[model samples]
Target: MDLHYVVQGNGEPIVFLDSGGADLRDWEFIAPSLAKSYRCIAYDGRGAGQSPSPIEFGDYVEDLKNLLDFLDIDNTVLVGHSIGGRIATDFALTYPQRVSKLVLIGPGLTGYQFSPELVQRFEEIQSVAPNVEKMAQLSLELPSYQVVMTSPQRDRMVEMTKHNTLRGLEWQHLWKNLQVWGELPAIPPLNELRVKTLFIIGTQDSEDCFRIADLFKQVPDIRFAHIEGADHMPTLTHSLEVSSIIREFLGESKL
Candidate 1:
C-alpha cells in the first residue's frame, strides 16, 4: 500500500501503533523521546492517515506485514494502543518468529464483551452525531473521552479524530471481533508466546480495560505498569512519564 511514516533514531525498531480514530500524529509527542534510545517508527494505520483505507481489519494486518517486509524489519517490538493492540496480538499469534516483544498501552483486546449501552453510546457519538462541532464538543467534554486530551493534545486530537470516516469503521464488525478475539484472551495465550510483553494502562480508563489487564497477573516474563492520573490515551496525557516508562522497560528487558 506504500504507507507513509516518520522514522527517527536508529537502533531496535519499536513500532508504535495508535488506537482507532487516531493517526500517527497520536505518537508525535512521545516518538522523539523514544527515538533518543531506540529506532522509533510511527505510522498512520490503514484508513487513518496517509495510508490507504483497507477493505477489512485483516487488510490492515497485511498492510503492516507488507510495511515490515518493505522496510526489512525482521525483529521488532510491536507497541500498540487499543485496536492497534489487538492487531499486534493477532500478528504475534500468526507470525511468532517475527515479533521480538510486545507492549500494549490501553490495548483494546477481545476480552470483555462491550456492553450494549456502551456500544450504542459509541455509535451515537461516531455515526449519528449531527455535526463535527457537536462531535468535537461532546468528545472533549465527555469524561470517557477527555482523558486523552490536554489543552495542547486536544487540538491535534480533534483534528485527527475528525479525519475518521464514521461509516468505514463498521462498529458492528469491530464489536463482534472484540467479542470473539478478546474471549480467547491474549494474556493467557502468552504462555505459549516465546517473547516478552509489557502492558501499560491508565488508571482512569474503562472498567473493561482494567478487567482484561487483570487477567495478565499470572503470565511470566511480562510487566504491567499503571500510569496514575492517566486515561486511555496516556501518550498525550502523560507523555513524559509514559516515554520514561517505555524506555526503562525496553532497557531492562532487551532481548
Candidate 2:
C-alpha cells in the first residue's frame, strides 16, 4: 500500500485508523494485545508519521480500499478513532459489504456540524501559523485532553502531536483542513448504517462527541461504550480497557 502500514497476528482482520494528527502510535498499547487474537492493520495516514503527504485533497476512504485490495482482505473489522472514525464511517457507508463490523472512538462525522467553541479553539490553534509548537500546545488545550494531559501518557501524546504538527505544516496546504476528507456531499443517516457497530467515547470528551453518540442510536445494531476518566486519547490512557471492550465486542475469533 502507498500509505505506511503494519500488519500483525493472523486471525480475522481488524484495520485501525488513528485520529486527525496522530499515527499508529495511538494504538501502540491496544493493537499489540489484540494482535494475539486478531490480525491487526494499523496505518499512518497521509502526511502523518512515515506516510507520504497528499498532493491534493486526500481520498482517505479510497486509500483504505486500495490497502485492503493490496492486502487481499475481502471483508474485515473496521476500527477508527477521531478523523479516522470519519474515514471508516464514510467507507462503511460507501462500501458496507466490505465491513463485517465497525467500531468508532471519538469519531468525527462526514457532514456533522461542529460546535462553534470547538471551531474557534481549532482556529486559535491555527492562528499561531507555522509555529507548530504553539499549534500543537493549543490543539491539546481542549477539555477532552485534560485527563491524558495529567496521565503518564501525556509525554507520548505531546510528542506525537508536536511531530505530527510539524509534518502537517510541512504538507503545506496539501493536508487541507483537518475537518473534512474527500467525503461525498451526502452522508447517509445513522439509521442507514447497516454494519454491526460499536461506538465509544470518553466520559470527559467534547460535547460534540456525546452528540455523535446520540446520533449513533439510529443504528439498528450498534453498541455504545464509555471510558471513564478518559478524554480524547483513551487508547493511550486506557489501552487495556479499550482492548478488552473491543475483544468482547469482537468475541473469540482466532486463527
Candidate 3:
C-alpha cells in the first residue's frame, strides 16, 4: 500500500516496526542513535500513521515486503516492538534470506490468548472506539503504559495512540474479517530460525508477554534482556538502556 516510511544514516540496514495501534514514531529515540552507525528505516503499518487501512491479515506483511523490495535492502536487521515484533517474526519466517538478525521487544505470539480480564478491557476499549481521544486516554491509563514514561514521552505516546485509534475505527467495520491476532496459522518452530535473535522485555510489562518470553527458550542463538521497573513501552520509557543493549548485541553478533 505504499506505506509511509523514513530512512536515515548508512551501512547495514535496520528496519524498525511499530507496535499495534502505533506508527514509525515508536522508534523516535532509539532509531536516531542507531542511525549513526546503521541505516535505520521506520515505517507506519497498514491502518496506522499515514498508511492505508488494512484489508486483510496479510496486508501488513505484504506492505513490509514491498517496502524492502522498493528500497533494495537485503539481509537487514529487523527491530520490532509489540505487535510489530510479531510482524518481524512472521516476515523473517517467510523470508529468512532477507533477514540477517532479529531484535524483538515485548513481542506478541501466535495462539497467545488474552486473559478474561484483559479481554473485558479490550471490549471496553472497543466500546469507546468511536471516540478516538477517549480510547487513547484510556489506553494510556492501562497498567502497561502507566510506568516510567516522562511527561513529554507520555504525550507523544498519546498522540500516536490517538492517531492509530482513529484509523482503526475507520477500518474495523469494513475489515471485520481480518484477524489482528493470530495472523500466523501457528508460531513457527523456533529451532528453524537461522538468524541470530534478541528478545528484550520489561519485568513490569504484561504477564502474558512474559509467558511468551518463556517460549523463546526453544530458539537457537537467542539472547534475552529483562529490564527492571520498566513496562510495555520500554522503548519509550527506557530508550537509552534499550539502545545500549542493542548496540552491544550488534557488536557481539558481528563477532
> lDDT score of model 3?
0.84
User: Per-residue lDDT tens digits of candidate 1, residues 70-94?
Assistant: 8899879898988888778767767
Please list the C-alpha lDDT of all candidates, in the order they appear: 0.74, 0.88, 0.84
lDDT of 2: 0.88
The TM-score values for the models, in the order shown, are: 0.83, 0.94, 0.92
Give candidate 1 misplaced runs (Cα > 4 Å).
55-57, 126-130, 135-142, 165-190, 252-255
How many residue pairs clash in model 3?
Answer: 0
lDDT per residue for candidate 3 within 1-255, as digits (tens), equals 368899998999999999887888889899998998999999988878988776654456677889998999867999989999988988888899999989999998766777777777776787785888888777777787778445458778877888888888877777556454444366678777778999999988987789889887888889999998789988888888899889888983320
Candidate 2 vs. true structure, TM-score: 0.94
| lDDT of each residue in 16-132, candidate 2, tens digit only | 999988999988998999999889999999889999888887789999999999999999999999999999998998899999999999998877778879878877887797998
* Ranking of candidates on TM-score, top first: 2, 3, 1
Q: Which scores higher on TM-score, 1 or 3?
A: 3
Candidate 3 regions exceeding 4 Å error are 55-57, 148-152, 177-184, 252-255
Q: What lDDT score goes with residue 151 in model 1?
A: 46
Superposed by TM-score, candidate 2 places the C-alpha of residue 160 at a distance from the truth, in angstroms, of 0.3
RMSD of each: 4.1, 2.7, 2.7
